[model samples]
Target: MSPVPDHGEESYIGSDRLKGRKALITGGDSGIGRAAAIAYAREGADVVISYLPEEQSDADQVLEYIKKSGVKGLEFGRPP
Candidate 1:
């Protein structure tokens, strides 16, 4: 499968080595967290992302990308 274009880079969906694996990302809403989420999704890993309440949009974008990679993308929150 071909990789989808994102942030000027292309993500290959079929080249994922982590297919079926699950990962939890502490800051998966933005910055390094978002990058890691995309990479993991490309590698076929299901992702659980935690982010601040204010970062919902960022987290949603990352989760959307993860879903495009045909993997599960779960997002939660950082308790106050």
Candidate 2:
């Protein structure tokens, strides 16, 4: 089996540097949360997103982007 890449070889995503961390992103279905999702992935942190139930379309798009970031995307919401 192929070996997984190590953290040492990863590039820094932002000036803030959030390596080896996990973030629970609120309002993550769109806007800032969407942006943060990708940024956090590049920064080497796992991300989970939460948003309102009515925004499923937007949320789906955000989740798609998050997936492209190579991280997991979780959705949490109520019926709208």
Candidate 3:
């Protein structure tokens, strides 16, 4: 891991473009959805992410980041 990956967690410059909005991101436990989940919340939007039960740990981490922005964060887990 010479170069740590970037998930927009530190590079995104959100400015209310998504304020008063809500986003439901699928496969949000990792990958693009994870980035979106973080970005949306930082922009002042409530975020809901959907993931499988096995992915709860990853999803939970994402929620923690989202919650730090002082916005709502929710998760929907479906057993597969």
Candidate 4:
């Protein structure tokens, strides 16, 4: 994969539309969920992501990006 499936790591432009909000996202370890989590954080919201234990690595990446967005991020993992 070319990583062309944008998780908005760079190309997203946030305008604080979600400022002072909180979002809970499932499947946030990858795909659209991951993108949403990143976008939510960039838009100035605290984010919580849910995923399976096996997806922890991917979730961790999302968390990093979320933090870089200057928003708080939380994660929960369940056994698959």
Candidate 5:
């Protein structure tokens, strides 16, 4: 099967609309959830992402991007 396509990786300019906000996102290891986490961070919000343990690698990547936004980033793993 083909890997899921995620267009959220495209560069997005943030306007600080979500500044000082905290976001909790599920299924954030990939796809739309990952994209939202990136967007939220760029918008100046702390981000927490939850996903299946199997998706830890992907979640790590998203967390890196989130941290680059100069906001806090957290990862939660659910039992498979």
Candidate 6:
């Protein structure tokens, strides 16, 4: 099993550089994709993440962090 890694869970800080922006990221349930999702959310962009259905657990975590940024967070997953 791949360990669920921390994607800047406590290290990233934002300054609204990307306020009012929107971003769509594929494979965003983990790894670099998860990191990017967190970064975009912190920067003030509403984020949408797409991932395989089996990755829902990881995706949920990302969504939690994204929403904490006070921006909208959306997720799309494929049917297994």
Question: Ten-residue segment with the worst summed lDDT in candidate 3?
Answer: 1-10
lDDT of 4 by residue, 1-80 (tens): 78568889998978899999999999998999999999999999999999999888899999999999999999989563
Q: What do the candidate models score in CA lDDT, each in turn?
A: 0.80, 0.65, 0.87, 0.92, 0.86, 0.92
Which residue pairs come into collision in candidate 2? Answer: none
Tens digits of lDDT, candidate 1, 1-80: 25642541254344778977999988988777788888888888999999999888878888888888888988888445
TM-score order of candidates, top first? 4, 6, 3, 5, 1, 2
lDDT of 5 at 47: 94
Model 3 lDDT, full chain set? 0.87
**For model 2, how does the per-residue alpha-carbon lDDT over 1-80 read when each residue is reduced to its tens digit?**
25742222134345336666788888876666667666776665667778888887877776666566566666676464
The residue pairs found clashing in candidate 4 are none
**Highest TM-score, which number?**
4
Candidate 5, residue 5: the lDDT equals 67
At residue 34, give the lDDT of candidate 5.
85
**Candidate 1 overall lDDT versus native:** 0.80
Query: For model 3, how does the per-residue alpha-carbon lDDT over 1-80 read when each residue is reduced to its tens digit?
Result: 55866777778767877888999999988988999899999899999999989988989889898888889998898564
For candidate 5, write residues 19-80 as lDDT tens digits.
99999999988878988889898899999999998888888889998888889998889563
Off by over 4 Å in 2: 1-19, 78-80
Give stretches of model 6 more than 4 Å off: 1-6, 78-80
Ranking under lDDT, best-scoring first?
Answer: 6, 4, 3, 5, 1, 2
Q: Whose lDDT is higher: candidate 3's or candidate 4's?
A: 4
- Higher-TM-score candidate among 2 and 3? 3
